[model samples]
Target: MTYPEIKRFHSNMLESITSHASQSPVYQDLETISDIARLSQLPLTTSTQIQNSFDRLGVEKVLLAPIARFWYTSGSTGKPKNVYYGKRDLDDIATGFFQLLYLCGARPWNNAWVVTAAGGETLFGLVVEKYGLDGTISPLAGEMDMIKALRHASRLHKIDIIVTTTWLYLLINKIAKEPKEFERLVETEVKKKVKIPVFSTIVTKYLLRGINYTRLGGSLQNAKIGFSHAEALSPYLAKIREAYPNLEMHDVFGAAEQWVQAIQVSPEKDWLSFFLRYSIPEIAPPEEVIKGKEDRNYRVKGVPWYEWKKGLKGELILTRPNECLPLVRYPTGDLIEVMDPAFSFEVNLERGKMKITLPAIKALGRAADSVDFAGADESGNFLGFKVYSRQVSDALMTIRNVRWWELYHVKGSPGKFVFLIIPENNVSDETAFKDELLRSLVNMFQEFTAAAQARAFLVGGTAAMEDQKNYLELMITRPTAYELIDTEIKQRIKEGRSVGQLKPKRIFVVDSDEALSTLTRKKMEA
Candidate 1:
């Protein structure tokens, strides 16, 4: 579709949704907005509003009607928000997934292993059937270990494509790289008689044998392509490339509230191209939405995707009028960088040749994951700056002997950051490991110092710029063995209830020093 055609469709969708706004108590005030220009004038819908009126935001009697399915957010920061869909909404979402799969190099006859959570099964089923692909849905829930499932599926069938989250992909890569360590971990669990389904002696033997077989080219070798979503992929892209040298990787962007929105088409291209048919894309400046005044409401203005220029960074706003619970200018809480105003791609399908042109963007970490800190200048004036989860993750990924880590910032104390880490068992030199971590922290802080210095030079003189330095303090401590065991047991229990339950909470904020201390304690008395 041409740019003008896409704009017209967006305007038409806005008008259609407005006509139905009176039926929804949450959106009744939007009934008067008739066009895209007018729709931009209203405040962006916050997730809190949607959560507060979850059952009353859609069409009239939506709950009374037969709904297709209900989806939920990960609730990493707060309570999970719920959104219901009708049959039509499912159909639209399936269509979007179909296109996304095609862009990810999926063919009709190829066998695909789709590893996803509960809410996405029906949509993937539709895509598989409609596109004539042989697909299997491996629920992230239950007693089934996802890594074991992938190995068994690859052995049983010639799996060509694997779909899963970025975290899962990283975990798989880590296990693949160190099969012996994985075996030891599982052996420890077995010795302790952990009541997890995946820890059975029979399953453990099979999993170990499968890992060995894969080293000789048995599992995941047939799979030529992969699709990773549900988390930011940029921070770990280099690691993924090093691990899976032959596997073609594609990063997808979307949320539970809105199904698939954009996809990365090629490794040569650094941005994800939006699926214009599904929603109207918009960008809201970070200052107006997330990093603004202390008393400012979350609501902020947005610029339509077409008007966005290259290098613009902000929170992504989306308007999906076609959904059953139509979202009018919704704040998705995801940070993004607009890479190109117009990115074009041409593909040849069985039917004919097609060309797609749309705005391309890069998904940064979530806005909520960013923490702002301040330091007093030479004149006793406070200068503020922000740190992002991606920066910290990227720095940590460069360090050796690190298994998993979480960053916490105390709400009232912005200058101090706490890290709770679980290092690899091979890390025997604790002091050396800590020294390496501190080096990485210093390198990350240097980048911020340079940026702050430039800002200070612009605002004041060279003296103020020279005074700009790192003010952040790092508190790094390894989790005690008791705490590690407790966390692992809890995670396994949660996994029995849902897929993607093992995904880590990498970054968050605490209200008090007690909370931070509790999480970052190095030793616990039994």
Candidate 2:
């Protein structure tokens, strides 16, 4: 699939979709649009729109032959958006997963283990098995502990590759490094009534032995490759590399709306190679939305991926033309940087052919997870800058012991940033940890100031650069376990509902000072 071929395919998909638009309640209004080049004319489809119009199929009855599966987005920021897939959609998703595996050096002789919330239904395991590799799916659904499953699988077979979410992988690596602390954390979770698998005494002993074995020489030690998704991998890459020096790690980017969108082809490369066959890619210019209000209803129009050049940044927009519930010019809300315009990869798979050139991109967290700041220079010229979750994570990763962290930029306090962190259970000296955190933050701000000054020099003049550094006030606090849980998860638990598959939300832009104050007050009370 070359760039031209992708364009042709995209146009054809648009034609097919429009032909049936009259019958589709969700896309009925789009029937008037004839030209594929006029895609930008359509308002960007949002998660809220998708959720609201879920029952209203965008495709005709023939396209919705049968529902293969129901998938939901992580809903980290809002309500979970539901997507219905047909059998072909499922097969396509499986093929996409296989493509990722093939590119990551998977072979027929290798043994792979997939640890995901999807349990036995995980397509990765099935695809690996179909490719004649030993495949195992260990669900983190509370039936069995993840670490236990890893050890059990390793004992039975030589695990060559481990596929799981970034957070799960990090937790596993952290536990391997500090088993005692992990045990204490597990005990705390159990006591807190969190639905985590409780290990029996015998199983606990075995788990300890397994951790010790990994320290020495075990299946995990010998594992050659790893695949991590469901969270940003850039900020945690160094930490993972330090933990598993011998293992090759690949970062996969995808959403429930569309599975396996891109994969990191090289360990040295910071960007992901797009899977053009799965979805058509586009970019909404960064400057248009970087300073926009944090509202889902606000739409951002995008240019085709080919139109965007290297070094440009934007929001990723994807269109899954073949899906039962087709996503047309859907705004993914993920901020991304274009690294290479002519990035190419070639892989020979037993079941499929793969030869394509596509733009490589680096995801810079969600666009909503950013704050725009403005201040006056000494000479009274207005200076503006932005801080994103990616930058924050990059800075926080410098400190090794910080387990989890969240940053808040309240609406009232323009230049103030609040940090809520949960250090590793092993930290004995809070003063030392606080000092290290402050130093890391100072370095981060310095780098930001330097970059801002350079931009000002290029765009304006010396007047723009002089005394442009804003006075940034930082507040740091450690939140208790109760305060650390996400508000939605807490509400769910309070209502006695199942809080399935948790992922960390590290950044927030609170709209009111009262909300921010309440958050801090809860921490204080805790």
Candidate 3:
């Protein structure tokens, strides 16, 4: 774990890495992996799910303690868990860095400043040292709080190279809303003197750095080659190139659990080459177009077709040339669209950080997101109504996949957005959740509907609603409610009509706090 074993890699990179994996007795017992991974068949993987698979397919003492550092995710909505990847996973993935660095024409002496999610021996930091990156690296300044750290590093220290996640860079832009903390942190890091580098991820997407350049001893900024992984790069970062024209921006296609997938030197237009990395990625989106024959649960179609003019982007899947993990064709939750005849897929700009265009435009080019439902504002913020209640539903997706969703009306002193988070599987989970939703529904709309006398029938018949829920409940009660929405959204999409956009209609807007009631009535009346 002292250094990241860096070496050049390319499309055939999988062969060499797996060749190394083949040397391991753990990987040698490949047949046992099926039971180890806990899958009848390899399906899509997110970091959280992979941890479970690792536990089932692996022993903690054998993998975690003996070989490497277990990398965990930020777990934005939940608790964090450590990732267990073997030495082969580390060794092979590093080839990607060597190859991409070679493409950018980098050197060994460059001072490295890693900006990945909390830089430590975590994944990226460990990889950098293994590769003999011969330079100082910066851990994420603290949960996407990188501005002060980067500014201080650039203006003061000696940074030569940079690597970090896309979210951290976006967060740098966000921290500005707090003026004092931003300035104070910058001033503090200045004393540390973390210089700019040739290996910084944030500024690497630059076009020129004549004036916006922070200098140390009057020298030009040093961090030249930048790698943005974890999430996709945004177009906002693209414009930064105007400030640091010499920087090299490479989009790294990999994750914590699985390590490296593919690498693209420039995502400015379309991803160019699929760096021969340790694993050959298979692109497949969830099955929405048709049903899965196995369980009939759901299935995603299409593979990463490198031949098409626009890259065939789907769920990112990987089958190592050596097959590091036990399963075959494990899908990564990331949605991608491949373009250019060469072997590259578009980073999903919709969900994570890599989106280049604005929200309005980002969804247009994509078929992966709520994009198929055109004309609907399937994605975007509805912050205005958020204060009224909790954001239980993804109201942003105008074109939803569920049978229907209700925006419950609440009249309370302390206002809340009573999102009757109905089960997408209400029909399957049966009357319990439906009844629960009904109770919430009654609680939300009872006063308003009763006073207005708009619809007594809707509230009075509780059993009727329960019956409806019973009939439509899904078979697989999704792990989480949000997951149900994600599953159903695609199902509704493939069968439904293809529209330019599908914007959600504001079915009900009840601002019932007495203070706003007068205004609400007026607005509703209008």
Candidate 4:
């Protein structure tokens, strides 16, 4: 914890930012935050602001240069916004990632089974793969839909560790539980002339199910760890633990703009420790986020990392000024709660001051956006409970083996929302799966439904109109949601409706018949 780099980070960041051509509105009156108290008074910046002010926010020299990587956010509507980073920025990113890997007990001898696209232009996947060259990497399919990628990975050497998204890990977990079924799956998918069921089962059993498989002179099950990134792991942690009790799981937190911001210090805890050396971190209460929704002009004031109290909930704000695209007071839209100090470690801040480690934080869901759904009243009200896409998507994806899914609200429709789900391939009990899915959905929206019913009663009307019969419309679909989205994206690009990199989103709200028709065209055509 006594790393000298930590002390120099703050001063270095301020100097680098101030030296830039500060033409942006965000930096019009800005100078320095050397005084930590002054940092609290600055207005918080949201992603929407960055998207809207991209032209005005750029430092001319950096924007015109070719030495930068442009990444985009996967927003629900419209064209995605781009985030730029320079070569030095990528180096810093690698350093941060290396620190996290080291903390997770990763060594040069480790072999990683990575579930990510091998040739795609995904920003996070590219960065992780680049920095992770300290060890061997065997790229697996990020989704079951990528049959060729999966087949290629199945033929790789034995794995010492596995790194993937929560959804893909669940798919692997399901396959590992049934080696015979997995054998049949590989035989069918690879399209080989000969059947290798026994061989397939042996490979799967040793690579996925057996604890005695050797790695680095230790049991592979004990040596092999799993890391889930860019999403919450809490929703799927218990199920993963039940399937592979010996596997150590780690959760990582980051975004497109600021890659690898924080990582879980230990496998035993849910909280994350921030990489303070890479970025300046801050937080504001839930009330600030709610207030900003009512007024777009209002900017919330945030407390610096040093000022956050244990148990306090707020969104993460970061200042990474050394990048090609500098972000100051950037609101990441992710909600997190500060946790009590997990351990004690002393460090020097280079200003003749000694400080202990910062408090850990647990990620809550993202800040809620005001979304009008099918169950809303005629006046576009949904009782008193505020509904957000993150809330519904997070709740629905908690169901077992759910890979890609979405909830859509059709305009002109009352008391109904379409829940389109794509379960993993091996889910056999359709009835039970649907029932469990409905149960989870109902549990998620129970409060909103109860409030709606109470409002109806007070108005001398029964709650029959808003009952489950009227509201719940579930569909288990053939094509994965990602496939449909990718098709749309490709079509859009071909028609010149989009340019540069585009990010596909999982959940969306369509306001017109034409837009809705486009999404359902695949089913209609079939």
Candidate 5:
């Protein structure tokens, strides 16, 4: 439902929730939600805001019982931003997550180790392990810890499931860190590599790199199935299927706040299903979980991009069972390609035997950070390029550092609306990287945006630009450095910053690639 409709619906929800129970700070907002149907009218809270709230709550671990733990790596031991989640949110995280696993043929009873965020002590890790019938589970934060956790979990006789964040697993599998040790554990006697089932919430280029490594290691032959959740799964997972021969790779979705599990991925005919097991799935405007302003672009410039897009792509709005916590239509950031109109209920010929069924769904990712670039016409109609911006976004997403992005192209000018990407994590020498990225980005966008892709480039925050002669500098080593400067200029235009307006990309930022090759190779090369 649109935010307004959801707001209207929330009036009844507010009455129902308030009358039924009184907990969570949002209880008071019921009135506000009922009154303000626009998404903007609601107060939005970011992960950062949530962290502040948690601090207000404190870490005694005493008052809240059935005491639950939440893990935070504190940001790679260096993560700049801090995010907070309640125990309840974490505990119920598996709805969509496990559905994807089931899609990939996860043995619910199999003992699997989860290697993900540092906050594993929270509800997510414990619940997955707890729900695991025979599934022995373990949680590890970051790369080294995941390796250690996996190594220790390998000792168990029946562990067959593995979960990890994008980087933690990528570093171990792709960088070949401690190759000898990794090989040993992968080839461990009790849990053979081929036999281990990997369940990641999502797979991006990082996981693509891992799949490549797994191909090289020849350990893939031992893996039974690979499951991706969290974010979109790259098509590269298909490579995992190729290398393993007997293995399958599936993408799953979920969060700390889902009411019931929703299977976001469309499975192959023979693939196992989850529609019947935990949650139901539907295609609609996502529920307004985040309290944001109404008039702003429905899609935020950059918070998290779901695989789902409107028209060409529809978001998978997860539904919550009323009996459960009642999370309805939560925006999962998962994007799905809506082809052939829509789909309806169907049977799981494969998992029907297992009794865990999945409902009918449609297209999902075959690439990373990929989005459906369905554009709007001058009047906001589908520009008929439902697929353009998506291609560019996927290419830009490959930067591996950005977290937020917007694709812009100028009208009637060689100046393409510039695609702006904000790094999710703090970065260094971004100007140099921008140039290096520009070249690659242009090449990537060329495949989709054609002439327009030439202009887009990656940009770092002000802190990283301190040394540069110009504010907006492209890495000499990167691609399409020239296009970046122009793109930014166009972005300003679109933002209504006029020729008289002096913005960073315009008068302040300069695209310089001097000596950027050496700098870029040093920065980007493996």
Candidate 6:
């Protein structure tokens, strides 16, 4: 049951290999994934290739699809990449999304509003609101427009569910909290609006921020259910629970590159149980990916999804039969941890109650994001320290009044680190802010640095260790500078960019002067 799509995947793989192997664009030479074993033999694929050369990636089937839709990622990595979906693929995704919505208490009678721009990831949610809900869907594009939409829907007493990104929700709440006439207007408008539920696919940091501002008026508190996905939920579920107490927070996991993978079986549980009806899943442990003297072949054989046991941590590999995109053992880049299977959970489907006990899964960021710092150990053995970007992001969230921020790792002989931040208006003490920010980063990254020191100690490279220590410079920007930076970002996006393609991380490695100059610009005429 875990790999119901295997036969289909094998057939597709065969067709692609026999018909288009030599001339196909993304992959030049390829082995056919005829069976589970052969699937393991296929080389891994990365997002970089998908972004830079998607047209070459088995596009024959895509061209032949009866109906095809194209969406591009927000070129945050440099250039926006296009993702193709066939009519059938989109229909499956839309159907799964709607089912998740229905499972989360949404109904056709409920007046739904989607507060996202009309592109990329938002398109899926828009589809769900349109197809799943019997109620009318109000698609609001921008933050101000979202507020207005909510107000209009509330005035009509028809707002049952409002869907938006967590950041936009926070922005709306922040504006409502301001002590201005506008705040009074928002408070009055919100108070008069219908108490509706909210759904968002967001990062945890913004969820906390949004929850803190939910009390601006009774409108947000009326939000009984909050469905979120696209990021880990367990880490921040407690905070969300404490904020609302009555709000039911559900997690739904999916990606633009792939269809919806999992959804919470129940609001009471923090598990995102995978649905086997989608793509066939496989798990590869972290250790197997590393090469040894005897084992030059590093990619470990991944276990089937059904074989997954609790506490198993590995990179998720998927095999899809969708003809528009034939993905065989494609490394999704997402690291996941397996959880216990649901004994039996019933979801009130559109027709009736459906029972399931699929194994739950937890995403642990991407393998690319967890960078490895290689050095020799005391015995002259090579040791690599994996520093997860999530650690840095988690530390950033700890800093009070930080509205948004980015950590840039500038490459050099001794690479320098720069932390740019936009603090909330209330954070006036810049000196204290810098001191606290530096302290937090140092503490969070202390273990990684210590590992480096131990590596130097083993190799007896004192000078090298000193250089490493010098490379760990952390710099924080002035709080108010983010306004100028924000303006510049908006201008760039306006020129033609989808927000979905933008990098979700505040931390990134900078390799060029052009990027540095743009990032370091401080003068503002506005």
Q: Rank the candidates by TM-score, best first.
A: 1, 2, 6, 4, 5, 3
Clashing pairs in 1: 140-499
Off by over 4 Å in 5: 1-29, 32-104, 121-124, 127-138, 153-160, 165-220, 256-265, 269-342, 345-526
* Top of the candidates by lDDT: 1
lDDT of 1 by residue, 276-369 (tens): 8888878886667653223223446677877889988778888775445677677787888888889888766778877778888887777767
User: By descending lDDT, how would the candidates be arranged?
Assistant: 1, 2, 4, 6, 3, 5
Q: lDDT (CA) for every model shown?
A: 0.66, 0.64, 0.39, 0.58, 0.37, 0.56
Candidates 2 and 5 compared: the better one by TM-score is 2
- lDDT digits (tens) for residues 1-526 of candidate 3: 0011111232234334334433443444322231212222333323444455456666442232354544555332234455455565556556655655655445666666664334243554555666676544454423223443545444434555566554344333334234445454444444344355433323433312221232421222345676666434443354335433555676665555455555565445425344423444555534532233233234444343232235344445555543233323445445555454333223433255341211010111222222221112221111121111111122221112232343433333222333323333334544555455545444434443343232223654655334322211112123244434434333323322111111122224344445334423322332
- Summarize candidate 2's per-residue lDDT along 290-355 as a digit string, tens digits: 322244345556777778788777688886655466777777778888889888766556778676
For candidate 4, write residues 1-526 as lDDT tens digits. Answer: 4434453556566556544525455455656555444555555556666565655655453352345565544443445566677777666666667656756766546666665433222443454566544233433323233343344345445555667666556656555455466656555533442357676556544333332212311322343678777567777787777655677888887776776777775665666777677778778765675565445556667877666678776677787764455676677777777885333433323355443454688776556433433344542335534455445655775666675666666544333456777665546777888888888887888876676567656765665434534455676755344456556644444432212112244445666547766886674343
Following a full C-alpha superposition, what root-mean-square deviation does model 4 have from the true structure? Answer: 8.1
Model 2 poorest ten-residue lDDT run: 492-501
CA RMSD (A), model 1: 5.0
**Of the candidates numbered 2 and 6, which has the greater TM-score value?**
2
Clashes of 1: 1
Q: Candidate 4, clashing residue pairs?
A: none
Instruction: Give the TM-score of each candidate.
Output: 0.80, 0.78, 0.48, 0.65, 0.48, 0.68
Winner of 2 and 5 under lDDT: 2
How far off is model 6, as Cα RMSD?
9.1
